[model samples]
Target: MRVMVFVKATEDSEKGFAPTPETMAMMQAMGKYNDELRNAGILLTADGLKPSSEGKRIAFDGPGRRVIDGPFAETRELVAGFWLWEVKDMDEAVAWVKRCPNPMPGPSEIEIRPLYEMADWQE
Candidate 1:
């Protein structure tokens, strides 16, 4: 099973707050977890993302086009980073995600979802 682990964004993240020393240390711990996953042959890829301010959102409708810039949302529950990992099942994916350090300073969240396999689409 392949899973996507979402690293949620915070208010400070939208305002371009750099990671604090404690946050950086937590990230380092995450890196160690990633390394362990890789060694166990589960992790496919993982990385943090730049602030959403650098991103662009495109909207299109019937020949009308618009592009909007980010820090798009005022919500704290936005994606800031992600990890793609292969595991035996959803349970394993959940276990890995459970072990991750909180990625944000306050009220952070991580969402883990299994990726759809092509075989699942076959009927």
Candidate 2:
């Protein structure tokens, strides 16, 4: 099964604050964790995102599209990064996430969601 792991953004991340020394150390730790995942052939790809201030959004209303600029008002709703992993099951993905280093200062969160299989569309 494939899963998408979301690294939730904090206020600091939305504000475009650079990682602190401690946060940097945590990132280094995460690097080692990523290496482990890579060696296990579970990590397909992963990347961190720039702050919303440098991002843009396209809104769709029927056939009309509107371009909206950031930084968006909701920091809590923004995603900071993501990881794509191919694992045996949700259980395996959860185990991997449990080993991740704290990616930010203060409270942080990560969400694991399963991806739909290609077969699901064949119905």
In model 1, residue pairs whose N, Cα or C atoms come closer than 3 Å (at least 3 residues apart or on different chains), thus clashing, are none
User: For residues 1-123, could you state the per-residue lDDT of candidate 2 as single tens digits?
Assistant: 999999998887886656678768878898998999999999999988989989999999999999999998868888999999999999999998888888778899999999999987896
Candidate 1 worst ten-residue window by lDDT: 10-19
The Cα error of candidate 1 at residue 19, in Å, is: 5.3
lDDT of each: 0.81, 0.90
Give lDDT tens digits, candidate 1, residues 1-123. Answer: 889988888776666646689767877888888888899999888877778888888999989999998767665667788889888988888887787777777778888888889999999
RMSD of each: 1.8, 1.3
Q: Model 2 segments beyond 4 Å from truth?
A: 17-19
How much lDDT does candidate 2 score? Answer: 0.90
- Candidate 1 yields a Cα-based lDDT of 0.81
Q: Give each model's clash number.
A: 0, 0
Q: Which predicted model would earn the best TM-score?
A: 2
TM-score per candidate: 0.87, 0.93
- Which residue pairs show backbone clashes in model 2? none
Error in Å for residue 77 of model 1: 4.1
Q: Which lDDT value does model 1 have at 97?
A: 79
